[model samples]
Target: MQPEGQAKRLVIVSDAWHPQVNGVVRTLTKLREQMEARGFEVTIISPADYRSAPCPTYPEIRLALTHPLAIRARIEALQPAYVHIATEGPLGIMARRACLKNNWRFTTSFHTRFPEYLRERLPVPLSWSYSFLRRFHNAAEHCLVPTQSIHDELAERGFATLKVWTRGVDRELFRPQPDVDLKLPRPVFLCVGRVAPEKNLESFLSLDLPGTKLIVGDGPDLHELRRKYPNTVFAGKKEGETLARYYAGSDVFVFPSRTDTFGLVLLEAIACGLPVAGYPVPGPKDVVGASGAGVLSDNLQKAALGALEMGRVDPDVRLKGFSWEACADIFESVLTTIGSAKVLKSRKVKSDRVIPAP
Candidate 1:
């Protein structure tokens, strides 16, 4: 530590990025832009790209999973002031443990409700998994959450030092153009995100209603799912203008994930003026309750049917109070605070490293 005023370097480690088509990747990418603009030197450490929903529009970032001892040596050579571990995977665990032993502070993000997601797919009860998750996150000095609801939920379950830095939607890309109608038949139902079993997408496909199902993403389950449900139009992964058009064209957006800590995609659907219809769970619960954004239910079929009866809501209602600019601004503040603290901490560490044991 060379005095409190020295500049600090920030490194972020996560298992999700680039190829992963989810909220954390989007948030971290935007946050990187914001942090760099604020004069912080940023480094990202992530695993090699893996299979995600494969959004065609956005280019993937360059990443490496675990570079041997040589890669670790290279990272240490850079001398990062703080390592911010954002996921609980092999790479992230290594980063966190290394930082902890060396007296360096690290922060983490709670994005996915992994316990619930894994439980829905596997055999373990959520309670046992939650305790395991709590242990993993408790290692961090500060763990970030995207909503007050998630924060409260985690806190109640014994997670500590929770913080909030919400996800943002790109308003420019997802602007509401009510003048341009999709011209689909009345009561069109749209479902975005992965077409996998975990997404609980089968319910949306079986919505026994009047309109066509506009399925706008792809996953491993796409082939069988498309074949099983001829009612759905498989539009694969789309982005930018294409995605906005898909959202704009639909009358209702159907999301079926209860395991999302914050459904950034839910906000994206709302941003395009498409009223949402999904289960009354975590992601939808937060977005809908906060913005009165869309119709929701415990049953997807019920929600879809209820949406048809909902008629039309003012588009401006759901579109209000959301923007990517605002999300980036909040992220800037968090990085600034962390950067300042890291500088002071580095100085103390340096001072201690120099002094001999008394």
Candidate 2:
């Protein structure tokens, strides 16, 4: 239960949630858990609560079919002390409109690089997508980014009030298991994430590496990739202890995406004492650059082979500043600052009111 005097109610609106596993879902889940444990009443508004239709191209993600008025009514009924919009999908757009119409302050987060992702699949130009995104996020009091590199990139693109919000790994769940073994060929190179074009999975699969090349998780390109690469092993979607075991058993974790805002899997793999190899991109550069826990190079094949030489990593030292508790602390601090500013503005308006006519 919340303490007697504090206003701790929080409402989070997001298009990303359960039933579709990804970094955004995982981050929000952990954030909510951490907030609730600290006596905050957290309510998440998602597609699961309303009538929805499958997103075009990506059938796994559902889009809400309701109108903005419906979202406004829900937010009004909740009477939350703080509001956070987590994505820029249909639901997030409606929630943003609701907050604007009601003169309520809300914060947003930049999770995916939609501009680059769209360019990969469609003919949409990067400037057009980035403009829409900039406007969507600039409306919020603050826009939370996953890393400093991402923050800088968005700032250059004209996004305002950008703040860095790092991700964390569950140390207890994802740790080195000495006896666990996948029984695959030695020096197994693994990549765990959605099997989509934006993931750049083909880059890793095409590499002339030794031993096994295993993939975990599923997406639109799973069947086709499985058919094309018969020599590689695809373990499909995994969770909990099973997923942790896969990380611990792997010889090296290979990440190929060049557009990820921040790769949470990097932290997960490192927590399991597994070395990583990826391109010298934003996500990899921020997560593993000069860390000695992973290898980053323009030549991904060379990086993969180099990572094989990294013996064991101490998760305690590598993940010292990453934890759900720290993540929640940053989130709460941002909300508190916004709320405080709102109160001060109201007080100033009251003080400036004319009283001579009365």
Candidate 3:
């Protein structure tokens, strides 16, 4: 590790970048800020820097069409102290290859459940997808996950070298804005995130709960969901102060997703003094964690109603353990470990090779 004041370069390769406002993007953006604050120079290799094609069914997420040689050249030019692949997309694959061809050790992060996502849209077997992802991640020195539940789930599915890399909420930006006028009815049960099948929005929308059901954010399922649930208000995509206002304006933040590795929106809700209601699943299970911040139940209706009666918990205290600073600290430690592994491997190669006597 470098001295306290020393700055080291970190090159991050991710297929998911700007114009895509998801958890992975949010997490990476915050992570880069925190890392830079801690004396690290960060370089991002994203689709923005190369020619790209739109991902089918998800045109918002552009796929990099850059050549392998170009990727290697760019990475080599940066001469980063460490390389971290932030997604399992095209750019990540190229970066992995570059590192492997140069015999350089790199770290990777599993931000989404690709196997589950794929199975949702295709007739592909979960085992085949998991097997494919397993090979991609297994090549890395370490694979960072968001929660223990995810770490455990991935481990069960044959993922190795896993580490728990938790996420943090931007409390300053997501704090309670009780003064904002949502003009919705009392006990407004709001769900924020992409309105897609994987998010289980129908489970919440279909709930026969009293009060206005508000949906914040947009997705492919927006039009269909809007048509199906005419009573529920679809506010489309919201960000910055507007998003926080939506969070604070609501009584309960209903998270119906069963697939998210970590539902970052839950943290944002808490940060905005909104309680959560969701299934007792991985993402919500870890975040709520016995803190009276939210209610998790098998019955979505029961959970949503239960959350309305609960008072908002102090996010500052409830989420005292989570912060970008700490997240960055752990990330830095991981980079340091990878650097050490590189040094050890270099030594091993020298020690093992038979040199001719001169």
Ranking by TM-score: 2, 3, 1
- lDDT by residue for model 3 (166-273), tens: 888888899977687788777799999997778989998889987799999988999999998899999999999889899988899999999999988988999999
Best by lDDT: 2
| Residue 11 Cα positional deviation in candidate 2, in Å, after optimal superposition | 0.5
Residues 104-163 of candidate 2: C-alpha lDDT, one tens digit per residue: 788999999999999998999999999999999999988999888999999999999999
> 90, model 3: CA deviation in Å?
0.7
Off by over 4 Å in 2: 1-6, 336-358
- Residue-level error in angstroms, candidate 1, position 104: 1.0
Model 2 residue 167 distance off true place after TM-score fit, in angstroms = 0.9
C-alpha displacement of 291 in model 2, angstroms? 3.4
State TM-scores per candidate: 0.83, 0.93, 0.92
Q: In terms of TM-score, which candidate is strongest?
A: 2
Error of 2 at 352 (Å): 12
lDDT of 1: 0.70
lDDT, residue 188, candidate 3:
91
Q: Relative to the unseen true structure, what is the C-alpha lDDT of residue 74 in candidate 2, on a scale of 0 to 100?
A: 94
